[model samples]
Target: MAWSRDEIARRIASDIPDGWTVNIGVGIPTLVPRYIPQGREVVFHSENGILGMVPLREDESPDPEVIDAGKNAVSIRFGGSFFDSSVSFAMIRGGHIDLGIVGALQVSQNGDLSNWSTNERMIGGIGGAADVCSGVKQLWVAMMHTAENGTRKLLTDCTFPLTAVSVVCRVYSDLAVLERDERKWKVVTLSPGTDLLEVRNATGFPIDI
Candidate 1:
């Protein structure tokens, strides 16, 4: 079976190196903190100026004020700090973030990111995505392998608006984990019981083993 949203989040969380400062984006990326391997010490940063972010427990009430970039209520871990949006973006642009986990609408074989649009379902702007993609020391993407219409999201070339070019280091999809090696995307891991053919068929672009 394919990895569920939580499973995918867990897989990525377990792989984060200890003591690294990570800036997480919206969507499935928000589900990561709760699943970070216990005992690992990673600082989570949110674009809207919150650091040391923890997902609000279901039992917790919304603070309205303390939230992540997606505007989801989040709890700040002890010693966490808040800054203005400009300062938060400064940290990203200063190349202090070790890794960024972001969602995608499509990813090209060349590792371009397409996350924003001009139409409905859009945020009406790129909203810090460009900074996150361009400024992070390493950028990785989390998304489903296919679009809602069953279209391949791993494409020969992204058809939607691009967020950044050649910025992605890896992609964690529902079906597989892909690592970028120069011009090729290596299938690093597959979901249990999933075959390479299924992944290949699901990808719009050619991938390497």
Candidate 2:
């Protein structure tokens, strides 16, 4: 069985440390704020120009004027600070963020990331990905383990354009929790009904489970 979305959220939440500033990229990374524990003093930064943002209400968009990196409408929470894009990049490049959660298209064995684009589909710009990957203390990549056709996304090497090389420290996918060891990716936790060999077979690499 594949890991549920809540399980993936918990795995990402477990890695967050108290009082650390975090920047979450678009997609599944947005879910991290929902599972943060109480009194942890976590400040979430948005490249769309907000810091210390609280999770927006799911029912209604609080402020049509306010939004996140993904351009999703949001509301400002008490104690949240707002800044322009230049200032946001400064914070990212200055190493003020402790951890970043990002979605990826492909990840190599050595932890290279390629989430910026899909060769066949021209979406939008790469945004602040390059800056965040290089500046954050640690990076957590979140995505499904396989493509829609069941092709492996985590591999011995990434074929998509590289976003950052050797920057990913951990991964949270629908199939398992993975960590990078030396030049190899290790399966730290397999999904229910998935054994060690099954993970290795799906990874298409020498994964240490």
Candidate 3:
């Protein structure tokens, strides 16, 4: 069976080092905080100046002022703080973030990222992606393995405009966990019932198991 969005987030959460500060990009990556391992200390950072973001409780009313970078209502953990975007960006650009988990439209075997836009139209204006990709010690992509048309998103070369080159260290897709070593892409884990052959056939690029 393929992993669900929440399962993918859990998988990514398991790989994050304890005590690391992580910037959770919008979309699927935003779900990561809910699945982080118990007893572990991980600080969630938002590009919009939120630090230590936690999941909102169902019974509690959401504060309109407390939101993540995606503008979704959220809660804050103990010691969480808020600041201006400039300060938020400084944390992102100054290499203070330990890990960055982001979504992608396409990722090349060479670790090229193209997530922000397709064609010439700007989608969401590439908010903080460039800085996050470059500033984090490790960058991981969390997204579906294929496009809506069933076209493989893991490719030999990205057709979309590149957001950053060779910055992706790992990818946690619904089907597998892939890592880039130098110039080679390898499958480090597979979803239940998925095999190396399936992964090879699903990807547009050659992959080592």
Task: Give the number of colliding residue pairs in candidate 1.
Answer: 0
* lDDT pick, better of 1 and 2: 1
Instruction: Give the CA lDDT, 0 to 100, for residue 136 in model 3.
Output: 88
Best by TM-score: 3
Better of 2 and 3 by lDDT: 3
| TM-score winner, 1 or 3 | 3
Model 2 per-residue lDDT tens digits across residues 27-119: 888877888877777788998788887777778656867888887776666788988889998899898999989988888888998988788
Q: State residue 162's C-alpha deviation in candidate 3, in Å.
A: 1.3
Ranking by TM-score: 3, 1, 2
Sort by lDDT, best first: what order? Answer: 3, 1, 2
TM-score per model over all chains: 0.95, 0.92, 0.96
Model 1 regions more than 4 Å off: 58-60, 118-124
- Tens-digit lDDT track of model 1 for 1-209: 99988898999999899999999988899888989888999999999998898888788898999988888788888889999999999999999999999999989888899998723567557999999999999998999999879988888888888899999999999999999976688899999888899999999877889
lDDT of each: 0.90, 0.84, 0.91
Any residue pairs clashing in model 3, and if so which?
A: none
